[model samples]
Target: MQDEDRRRYHDLRPDWAESYIRLERAASLIRTYEVQFVPGLLQTPDYARAVLSVVHDDPGEVERRVGLRIRRQALLDAPGGPRLWAVVDEAALRRMIGGRELGRAQLDHLVALAERPNVKVQVAPFHFDGHAAAGGPFTILRFPDRDAPDVVVLEQLSGALYLDKPSDVEQYRRVMDRLCTQVEPLDRTAAILRAIRAEL
Candidate 1:
């Protein structure tokens, strides 16, 4: 895409999302726990469009948002990209956005991405009791620079919340640690994804 498109992407984001994006691009490690739909960083284009369509009626706006999401995904494969670790709840897989075909493709994409050394995808099986992050989806961004502080992002319906205080960051960090323990491991993650895809 042209540099202008990149600029437009930045311009389109809500102020809160724009703030998180700034930290996202700078973080050395991005840890996410999603309970609903697929995490934005890992979403497929069609899936992303299906998501945006629910709230946005304008096709042009949906396409613009999808373009931005897909473009953001490139950083996962870019040189010296941040290491991504995501724990996705089984509910997200079962939700099946954009119909079966699109959902299947999205699961396949997740399984493929897990193969990368820097990317980790896990599933919190349906059997799990009392989900650690029952509040909703959130992400923690960590930078390599010790001088930089870690931040937590809490996404809401119309805007986003950023947490930068040490105590706030630490609380989410503990939640993430406990959350990871509840999900399947790397090997099982791939198998779980494929099994879900088969059902789709």
Candidate 2:
């Protein structure tokens, strides 16, 4: 069943491409509910580089991709841009992707981002019991207009799968609500990062 669902959305069809266009235009607030790793918008250059390095064989191309990612993060900081909220799993903060120093830096970066009025950061502690999100990482992007359909992006080994179907989006929204309830409050999440920094 999982494989069938994966196959269904693996390739971006023409209709999916159109939906992506609509999503980009409609999105006014981006809420990311992440389970396996930190959201891309919160990743530091060093952290992103380390992640991309493992996948890209050519150093030159890897640098280009990292640069692009850094540029993309600017959208979150742009004036009058969409608000960003991210809920990350504790394991993401604990993962030593680029060693202790880089991990600490990344956590510190997330703390800084959490300070922004338009950005909210929450962390799901390891102590939480298994829930709907046990399936994997997913992101929900909301718009200012309630009438607009929400977009859900699911990540897999192959690529990103975007869900815009009303029923599918609603399902993910419910899952997000459950996950958010399990996470520590924003202030607590910041404290957790600080404690991790101290340990490093």
Candidate 3:
């Protein structure tokens, strides 16, 4: 979320730091295209801790962030929660972020989540032809309110760029649609996850 948008939405939900949390909570649907790691909304506690450890030197800060992330997971199971549609690059699944055991557990968690009605997970295999999103990972947040526009979030190491422009939103939506066509369908995700988990 941009600083300006943060201020605009400040009255809606009064929470400080990372206003993206408010938008995430308000979104009715979230579409994510991830090439490097699991989406935050779907990550397990161990995996979240492992990822946070690399950036934060303070163990206490890492635990705090991990706890916040885990608490956010509850939204997925809440009644009438937003739908989560994720297209993950196959390499992300193969990478052992927290070592083999943790990787396997992560995959197991993914398999379980895919069973939810509102959650859709797809794997973009290495052999995927004509990759649409060469630029890298991004997430699109959409609200149920018809008047509110779609938002595209492009993240970097330091911060994230939020775009609500109609042109930008459509362009990213097209890329996401193309990526979905290139990746395995929802039904095949389970078998793919199991195979990768076996490798771990």
lDDT of 2: 0.75
| lDDT head-to-head 1 vs 3, winner | 1
- How does candidate 3 score on lDDT? 0.85
Off by over 4 Å in 2: 1-26, 145-147
Score every model by TM-score.
Answer: 0.95, 0.84, 0.90
| Cα displacement (Å) at residue 180, model 2 | 1.1
Tens-digit lDDT track for model 1 on 132-165?
7888899999998999999899888889888999
Weakest lDDT window of 10 consecutive positions for candidate 2: 5-14
lDDT of 2 at 61: 71
Query: By lDDT, is 1 or 2 better?
Result: 1
User: By TM-score, how accurate is candidate 3?
Assistant: 0.90
Off by over 4 Å in 3: 1-17
- Tens digit per residue, CA lDDT, model 3, 1-200: 34765464444332323656877888999999998889999999999999888787888778777877776777798777789999999888888887999999999999999998999999998886648888899999999999999988887776678899999999999999988887798899999999988877
Clashes of each: 0, 0, 0
